[model samples]
Target: MSGTLGPAPGRIAYAELDVFAAYGSFLVQDDTARPDTSRAFITDLMNNLVATTDGAISVGTARRRILPVTLDVRTEAPEDNLDDWDHVTEAGLRITSGRLVVSTFDYRTAIPRTTVPPGDYTARTYASGFDTISDDRIHGDDAYRVILWPGPTVEPRVLKRYPHLPIPG
Candidate 1:
């Protein structure tokens, strides 16, 4: 085994990324320090997420925007087209406790901590059709994907950025 955490079929996972009005973001953190929601969406407009630390990464979203998110765990880096997504960001995640927790800023809806071998890994988040979203029509207009693979730590990078989306302050 490459120490990858395999997908769980039928397991419902959703994180209300925009839980706090001031912080429009969700969390993908290991068993480390408490998530600093105040730090959410503060930097990296292009990437739309911030790696608070090696153990935590906050993914940005529109205010009160809730969309289905899929988590794909792979043994090695997967091939992806940067142009296919409106925005894409990559960062490193350190899982020291052998568990990864995905959740909202408020911790209201947390997918149970997933078990993985303690090690450094890479996380890439992809978003599509987000600029087309409007209040009258939200669902199905946008999509999100978070992929993880066994790898060494790396600095966050924005593979692509949507031009129309407003940059957070």
Candidate 2:
């Protein structure tokens, strides 16, 4: 990912290509593959990389725009004994403009929609943690996250709000 991160398809492609190329194994094709073994790998490598990367693109005479904002949910804790938590994700909206990029995990993407404009968009993300001994008792954090990425210069922000989780005695 670049210094600035968002949902740009081209940037994502470039990033993924850099990552995949480092491996060089995923690009290799079968020995019996057509006239050239590495043909398939080398031919559509860029397009393949772009296509495989999550997000859409729109190129115009003036400028190009990548349409898609990845909604990701990850554990904030180092090694919490929280299991069976639902890191639910849903399609939020699409953002265009700038060379911004955004990603948390080593490999991750989410449902993307091409509706709405660039601004603070609320996404549906929640997680539940339960007590080790008692199944009935629960202690969890359900968050309401808003992604703020208006433009390139603006600092990307993920404001999260955790609702109260009642524990059953």
Clash pairs, candidate 2, are 5-101, 5-102, 6-100, 6-101, 6-102
Q: What local lDDT does model 2 show for residue 25?
A: 15
Candidate 1 local accuracy as lDDT?
0.61
In the range 72-116, model 1's lDDT, one tens digit per residue, is 666777665576677778888888887667666434335466667
Clashes of 2: 5
Give candidate 2 regions above 4 Å deviation.
Answer: 1-94, 97-114, 118-139, 147-152, 156-169
Q: What number of clashing residue pairs does each candidate have, in the order they appear?
A: 0, 5
Model 2 vs. true fold: TM: 0.18
Reference-based lDDT, each prediction: 0.61, 0.22
Candidate 1 ranges beyond 4 A from true positions: 1-22, 37-41, 45-47, 106-110, 135-140, 167-169
Q: Which ten residues in a row have the lowest lDDT in candidate 2?
A: 56-65
